[model samples]
Target: MASIRAEDLRIEFPLYHFARSMKKRLLGVASRRVKEDPQNRVVISALSDLNFTIESGERVALVGHNGAGKTTLLRTLAGIYEPVGGRLTVDGEIGCLIDPAAGMDGLSTGRDNIRLRGLYRGLDAAQIAALEADAGEFSGLGEFLDVPIHGYSAGMSIRLAFAVATAFQPQILLMDEWFSAGDADFMAKAQTRLEQLVKASEILVIATHDMDVVKRWCNRVIRLEAGRIVGDEVV
Candidate 1:
């Protein structure tokens, strides 16, 4: 079954510009959120002492103010970032919608990126063909699919990326937020696709500021502050 567990999980980003002496001075004045690691590098703790478990069949929302580490936690769960301390365990296939352009190459054609993604995922030729078809149809990119991604508009890129990312079913779905940059028709279609994926997936972890969305789609809420989980409750 799909599940996620965080045991005192911590994620930190080092500040490369700080000199050793400056880092020491900053560390001395820093709150718990900033510190010098064992290697004496100055780092900002993006997630601190996070402990939570999400079992299969759960829809969890990560809510917090800006810079509260919502996206950081989502990236960590997506394996885009590694924790500097503690442990995080995720069981099952993970699909991430944290960044629309993630895993996509700006210089490559949309079709090329789609094929590369399929190959990277170990999909067979038939599966890759299906993925390409799905992305082509759902993205509405048509002739533009053969065009380099850099030539597409922001909305076009988002549409293509969303289509490709959601083409395959996943055991765990991690979404930062629903894309609003798409036009009305595309947004409606994307919503439908998201609902279908949420229903099919064993676990859904979304970081969103829309409480209305959380109430409508999620069963649980996890509130964070300064990278620390302050509240965890079932709705």
Candidate 2:
């Protein structure tokens, strides 16, 4: 079953220096000794007591302005960041592409990164080999897969990322923005395959500021502002 539940989730960044500075403010010790690291900066409140639940086969779009905590929430849900408070539960195979290049090693060749991502996503060697062959059709970086990924142009990296991400259908697929890349001609070809992923995936949660995408792709939508949910409704 594809399900997600988050209960009173609270995420916070620690303020070691901010706390210490409070004491300095009281004690009147004016010294620059605390400039050792940036961790002394004020702690940030990323997510504040958020609560939500989604049953099997539901689609939701996260809509928010830049830095309104959409990515932080998604990253928390993807288990990349541990919530400081609250409980979250997910039942499904989650495929996340929040950061297209998160797992890639720039020094590695595209071919190696493909295999690495496949393996990290839990596919065995035999299954990865089959998927690798199809990756070529979509990646379009012909002959460059063996070249270091650091040298790939932005378009080429996006192409390779899309290919690797859509190599398999997922139960719960998460995306930040549907990347727009490739030449106009290549994009047309890639669009068909990208759409194929949307059709085959069982559940999806996409984060975007694009209102048009939220309308077209999500049956339900939630809008966030300043780390709080300002609106939510079914489209």
Candidate 3:
């Protein structure tokens, strides 16, 4: 069964060189009146002592202000970032769309990217070929699929990436936010496709600031504050 459990999860990013020096200077002035820990390194804590469990069939929404660890948590769950401390277990095949162009090469053609992304997702040659036509049709890029992605606009890139990403069904789907770059007509189609994909997945976790989306699509809402989950509510 698909499931996710995180116990006291902690993730931090260490600052280096110029960034480290700047943080030190800023903290030094801010800490003169406050107690400063000598062992505290110049690091940004993204997740601290976070604990959560999500079972199969749950559509969970991560809701919080910017910098509240929503994206970090999603990335961590997607296996793009490892926990610095504590334990995390995920039991399912994960399809992550944290960044639409994550596995795509700007220098490569859209058709080539479909092949590359399919291979990266562990699809065999035959499977990739089977999905190529559908991906091309959904993208509406026509001859542009034959050209390099670098020549494509942001909306065009999103179309190709979305088409390729959703070509295969996943046991667990992770999305950072709703894709909103396309035109009105494309957006309507994309939203429909996205809803269908989400329904097909066994587990879905999305981080977004749109309350309407959370209300419409998610069954549970997890609110985070300063790297910790402050509230978890079932809707």
Candidate 4:
């Protein structure tokens, strides 16, 4: 079964621009002892002492004000950021929709990107062919898929990206607000696809400011403030 567990999980980022004196002053103003990594570089804690377990069939929403670590938490779960001072275990095939075009090569054709996505996921030739066919049909980009992605418009790019990212079913799905491009028909199709994906996944974690969406799709909410979880509730 796919699951996620965090034990006193802590994530931090280095403050490379801060002088020692400035760091000291900031630490004093914050009234907290400064933490340094093994290399002794000053760091700002992004998540602190987090403990949680997400089992199969959980639909969880990460919510908080801006800079409250919602996005940071999502990134951490996706393995984009390593915890600096704790343990995190995730067992699943993860599909990240954090940024639809995040890892795409803009200079490459959309077709090339489909093949690359297949390769990254370690799909066999038959599966890659299927993904290409699926993306081509779902994205509605037709001949544009053969052209370099940089030449596509914003809506076209998002459609292609979303199509390719979701070509395979993942055990765990992670997403940000993420649905802002395309026309009305595309929006409707995207919404349907999102619902289908969520239904098919073992676990779903999303970070969003949209309370309506949370209420509609999530069963639990984990709220954060200043990198600490303040509220964890079953909706």
Q: Alpha carbon lDDT of residue 84, candidate 2?
A: 72
Candidate 4, residue 187: CA error in Å? 0.5
What tens-digit string does per-residue lDDT give for candidate 2 at 32-96? 22222244454467777788887776678999888778888888878888987889998888888
lDDT of 1 by residue, 89-150 (tens): 99999988887676788899999999888987799999999999988899999999999999
Off by over 4 Å in 4: 17-28, 31-40
Off by over 4 Å in 3: 19-23, 29-40
After best superposition, candidate 2 residue 61: deviation in angstroms?
1.0
Each model's lDDT: 0.90, 0.79, 0.87, 0.89
Residue 178's lDDT in candidate 1: 60
Which scores higher on lDDT, 3 or 4? 4
Candidate 1 worst ten-residue window by lDDT: 17-26
TM-score of 1: 0.93
lDDT of 3 by residue, 53-157 (tens): 999999999999998989999999998899989999999999888887887898999999998988887788898898788899999999999999999998899
77-166, model 4: which lDDT tens digit per residue? 999999978899999989888887766898999999988888887899999999999998999999999999999998999899889887
- Pairs in steric clash, model 2: none
